[model samples]
Target: MATRPTMPAAAATTSPDDLLRLDRQVCFALAVAARNVIALYRPVLEPLGLTHPQYLVMLALWERSPLTVREIGQLISLEPATLSPLLKRLESAGLVTRDRHPEDDRALAITLTERGRLLREQALQVPPRIVATLGMDVEELQALHASLSRVIAASTPAHQPRR
Candidate 1:
């Protein structure tokens, strides 16, 4: 671990400008933005019977079904403990199957059910709705996604979490 650099007592006690305000903090902005964006998706996702996190899971499964729980967690940045209940709820809704992998009985495989496969048609509407709701040009949103991707990569730890 690195140690904090020591500063003179007078320097440590004062700010040159009033820049330590909450509205100026990047973390505060990120937190509020994350909440508001997720809130926007709430109403949009209601008809599909999905919460924000569930939607993320569905997106992973939509791209490729029969993924292992660990793979889904890695893709979605969720821990298994957090993801388990979501999988259970999806299973109960008959949208997905949590069964043993055909090749390896010990590993759980998450495959979309027939109903879930059909839901993809409805899911196709989601992106456009979100874009309209944000009232941003697709180019701008794409730029922001690229920026956020960079932020995530820069802020993430050097070591990946254990699978």
Candidate 2:
């Protein structure tokens, strides 16, 4: 049988108070960092006429268009309720078109417009700008991304058969 690794003795010896410290809390750090990083994207995305969430949606569509609302939500880890309004706004901006799927009347297909496709040219500059603003090299950001992926996987629930 395989065994799980344990924390080192020194780390295991942390007191309850040490564990309770706000600065040491992963959730606290993640929340603050998320807000700050999103704030950094605000100015960059503003000229592109997209908020951070909208930009994320565009990024997904740029990769694969004509995805259903549910598929886009799954790709972005956003709820359908939240994504619906964002899609509407993008449609309003003429960046995308949302139409009922011919095969599945209930499903809405999201496709980027010609303007949206052209916007990708401008959007290409965003990453390099953000990287410059963050002062982090591509390698460092890649490593951070890998670490965050591990953290996300560890935090999500594992599906198991019901008893």
Best by TM-score: 2
Q: What is the lDDT for 34 in model 2?
A: 91
Residue 72 CA displacement from its true place in model 1, Å:
0.3
Can you list the residue pairs that collide in candidate 1?
A: none
Candidate 1 local lDDT, residue 14: 63
After superposition, the stretches of candidate 1 with alpha carbons farther than 4 Å from their true spots are 1-17, 159-163
| lDDT of all predictions | 0.91, 0.93
lDDT tens per residue, model 1, 7-68: 86755676856457786677899899999999999998999999999999999999999898
Model 2 segments more than 4 A misplaced: 1-5, 158-163
Model 2, residue 20: distance off in Å is 0.7
RMSD of 1: 5.4
lDDT of 2 by residue, 1-163 (tens): 9999998785699987888889988899999989998999999999999999999999999999989999999888899999999999999999999999878999999999999999999999999999999999899999989998888777756733344
Total clashing residue pairs per candidate?
0, 0
